[model samples]
Target: MTAVPAVALRGVTKRFGASVAVEPTDLDVSDGEFFSILGPSGCGKTTIMRMIAGFESPTAGTIALDGRDVVGVPTRRRDLNMLFQSYALFPHLSVEDNVAFELRTQRVPRAELRERVAAALDLVQLGEYRGRKPQELSGGQRQRVALARAVVGRPKVVLLDEPLGALDQRLRKDMQFELKRMQRELGITFVYVTHDQEEALTMSDRIAVMSRGRVLQVGSPTEIYDEPANRFVASFIGTCNLLDATATGGVVRVEGVGAVPAVGATDGDVVVAIRPERIRLLPADAPGGIPGRVVEHAFLGDHWLAKVVVGAAVAPMQVQVPAAEGARLLRGIEDGAEVALDWSAADARVLPAEPAASSTRTQEVAA
Candidate 1:
């Protein structure tokens, strides 16, 4: 028999008085997969999460969990657990008590509750700190306690809403790996929500990128980063260099880079996007290259970020190179020094110019 999806949202919509918080959104999360909803604040990522958690009702459409409709189920009845951004730990309760609170509420036998709480603490590697109160634990420890509490019930799916947002940079990175390990061991679906692109890239098996309550695209990390669906996705996910080009017979004429044939482009104006690392810098007198002027350079530990002025464009094009290689290239070079830039046609992506109607259409649709 085919296993049902862990969670499925079919044309789900949510409205808050005058605002439509989540537009008609459809998504399916597979069993035991770590899926993420990624977007900026006010993009309705949380609203979708709330609907899945059964904390909020959809104004339209249906939601299913393991093939059973859960639209009207209350939060407590749904076989799902959520770890909020705030740890939400009880300050007065010890780590063990915090993890056992759910069991006590269900009136489980005291012996069983104690065993479950101990096992939960052990799962999070907090067994030694079971006696410590939330106020006595470190930030990461408290977050782990919260995670243990959520998983103690062994729910079908686990929802994490920016669960590591409060931790420091190093701790956050550490927890990303820990969470992935825990999810794999538990064999449960994980639906994570985050606005941080790096967090989404590192943790998720697949990410649904949203904007204004609409999902722009869904793909693996490499696909989303390397082959974005449109200009917004390309620009938002990472740093990209864009050039205005006119297409003629499948060839794009970049102002300084000359005409180059590209895939999926015909006769019209298009935007060419390439990553900084893909650009190659050469001396001004080097053959077969486009002309530019060095405007600024900054050494960033392992790499150097160089800004180069090309043609009438105001924003300088940025290129990243290894620090050692950059040092060699910058020898005797100074501000306003002419330079040559070159990149293969295969390195650039030709996209159609965004229609003005899209801006108005998105607004109207959102309205």
Candidate 2:
């Protein structure tokens, strides 16, 4: 973090009647950083985004843009641009006009406005589409137009709210790269809000995982994924197998299974989380393995997903292996056949059981 963040939210809170949309939270976004606020619907990610964009004022606390308090500033005067999921293009306007709307609104000189607009369009690879309208362009191309318009103003930060949610899966993935490239080229700070885990993981330089109007964790993709702060974060970011266990003599005694080696600090009641990909199938009675029955299996194109009934919990332990390798491994093992599961001790993350949840006092504003 620099002396002054590109966008800073200090003790920012927003309440709607008795419902808390966002609690008092402190966030600092660095200059040129690609930061995302990720959460499920009703998690207040959007509310926080609106507050930062000046669409909604925080119920309490301060919002600073480059160390300057902009709580009372208008959106346009705040030197920020908000890109919405809807292209929000004027249907009657040409591509160039759509990108030039902000500049014209600010009454920039005709000559300089043209130069900036052309540069913006060219950056998005839509230089030739200037003569066309939003309706004439493909969804991806229209999205490019929206992006060009967002950066055309050269705002200090661009707030994007699910900007790619409308595109098809493949097209959306493609735009992730395009958006990343534009962000780098423009060197503008981006505060993106998305509920799609894959989308956030793919595009964010750093992500703040939010739940119930509170940020559960803030870290890089690897940090949030590999070292989650709690069970909510671990389960939300990716697939996780949470099994009950008890710590004793540097080993976790899993219910209905043998003892497994533990790492880090493990004490009292605990939950062990092992990723499906980390587990390996072995013949029953193999050393350092727990025997179980293969309850179900599915081919997922890139890999195979297997459910093995084991441990005290009724839920089966999941195992995933490369499609080709899985075929060879299960060559003779029929469904319901007995097998053993093994994984490196280091791969298993032992977490404390029943971590306390925060009780932040806040609510969202009413429409």
Candidate 3:
């Protein structure tokens, strides 16, 4: 028998008046998996999460948790818990008391509640801080307290809505690993919602990229990064050099760059998208290389970003090189210096020519 998914959405949608927040969509999240909904603000990613949590009712379709329809169920009755960006810890309560609140409300035996709270605190590495109040803890510590409280009841699934958004960069990175660790140890299904691409790519088993109230693509990190479905995805997930071209068989012709290689290019007008890191930069005199002139460059700590205008192309092509290699290339090269661009056939993807719209024709439902 096939195992039922931990969470399932079929044609689920929401609209406030005539403004559609989420289009009809279908998705499944497996048991004990970490899934993420990624998109920019006002993209309707949060609306989807809210509907799943029963905090908002869908205008159409159905939601099932472990194959049981939960459309009209109250948020408290659903077998899930939610953690928010704000931590939402009680200021006056100690960590232990906060974690024990749910159990006490259920009238669970005092001894069992104590044991569960201890286990929860220990799992979050906050056992020693059980006596500390929310204000007494660091940002990360308070986040962990909220996490411990969310998972203490052993719910079937946990929803995290940009839970690390409030922390500093370093603290947020640290908490990413911590979140992954706790999820692994507890083996609970986690559905995380975040607008940060890096965060979703780092922690999610699979990601659903949303735009203007629609899911554009759903795939693993590597798949989404390497094989973007369309022009929008190719540009949104990371930086890419998009050039207008005409493709025939395995060759694509750029206006000023001449014929280049594209393995699976569709025969017609198309857009060739290539990652900056995939292109090689050589001295302009290099044999058989596409000719270009460096227009500008920027230092990004780990790598250097350079803009090169090739032939009669209207926009500059971006190239990213490692710090060491970038130092050698930009050492004495002035703006307008000559250079060459080269890449393998497989590195350049020929995407269908279409209008890459980031926003849809509806207002997003506010969180």
Candidate 4:
């Protein structure tokens, strides 16, 4: 028989008077997996996290942990811990005391609490700074203390609500790896909430892209990045170039670009999305390529983003190429110079546009 999920939500709904914070949602988080809920601000990512932590009760449906219902369990009574975006450390308390506070409240033996607190600090590589208060530590260090405190009690699941959001770019990247390592070593399920797509892509075993109060898609990073369920997932997850095309038989006719074979188009106008990296810039005389004029270019460390205007389209199409090749292309090209653009048929995704009444469906995916 299959083992029960570490955390599961069945038709979970949260309504604050007239506002529905979380629509009826269902999800399953496996044991020892790193799962993330990703979306924009006010997209209900935190509402879902709060529901799991029992900080907020669902208006309907059930929340289960390890096959047992925990729908009404109080935050302190549930066998789960949460690390908040703000770190939420007590400024007056020393690091050791902060990490041991939960255990102390539970009436754990003084001797055992000391040992457990020491172990938690050591796990976060802050053992020597145990005597320092929250004000005495760096932002990243304080965040570590919050993490250490959450894990000190050996909770069945840990929920991190944008735990690394306060750190700088470099520190945030470092902590992503550190958190993933810590999660693996402890063998506990981690349900993380973040609006950062890159962070979710880097760490999650699976990610649920949310919008408004609904989950748009749940899949591995590669699946979500490569085969997005719809246009919102494609556009929200990363940079994309969209082309208006007409579907006739098995071929999609792009204006000025001619026809290309597509797999899913059946009728009407279709929107084709292609990643910038998938596009190749060719010389003016190249065959089987659409002609365009270079509008602008920006250097981005290892590569360059070249914007080219195709036909009457006002929006410039972005193309990413290696810096070395970009230098060569730049030497032979200039602003307003005509060039050719090409991409493989398999690199593009065709999706039907949702109707006006279903426009709200797109908002649901942004959560």
Error of 3 at 70 (Å): 0.3
- Residues 153-195, model 2: lDDT tens digits: 8999999999999999999999998999999999999999999
Candidate 4, poorest ten consecutive residues by summed lDDT? 355-364
By summed lDDT, the worst window of 10 consecutive residues in model 2 runs over 358-367
lDDT of 1 by residue, 1-367 (tens): 8778989899998777666677788999999999999988877899899999988899999999998899999988889999998989999998999999998988989998888888889889999999999999889999999999998888999999999999999999999988988888878899999999988999899999887777888999988887877777777788988777888878778775677435667788887777899888888898877788999987888988889988766688888887788888875678888988888777788876772112212332221
Model 1 residue 211 lDDT score: 76
Q: Give the alpha-carbon lDDT of every model.
A: 0.85, 0.87, 0.90, 0.86
Model 4 regions more than 4 Å off? 355-367
Ranking by lDDT: 3, 2, 4, 1
Ranking according to TM-score, highest score first: 3, 2, 4, 1
Return whichever of 1 and 3 wins on lDDT: 3
Candidate 4 local lDDT, 1-367, one digit each (tens): 9989999999998777667778889999999999999988877899899889998889999999988899888887779999988988999999999999899899999999999999889989999999999999999999999999999999999999999988999999999999998899888899999999999999999999887787888999999998877777888888987777888876888777677535678777887788999898887789877888888987798998899988555588899988898887865566898888888878888877551112233234222
Q: After superposition, how far is residue 36 of candidate 2 from its true place, in Å?
A: 0.5
> Which is the better candidate, 1 or 4, if ranked by TM-score?
4
Could you list the CA RMSD of all candidates, in the order they appear? 2.6, 2.1, 1.6, 2.4
Off by over 4 Å in 3: 299-302, 356-360, 364-367
How good is model 3 by TM-score?
A: 0.96
Pick by TM-score: which candidate is best?
Answer: 3
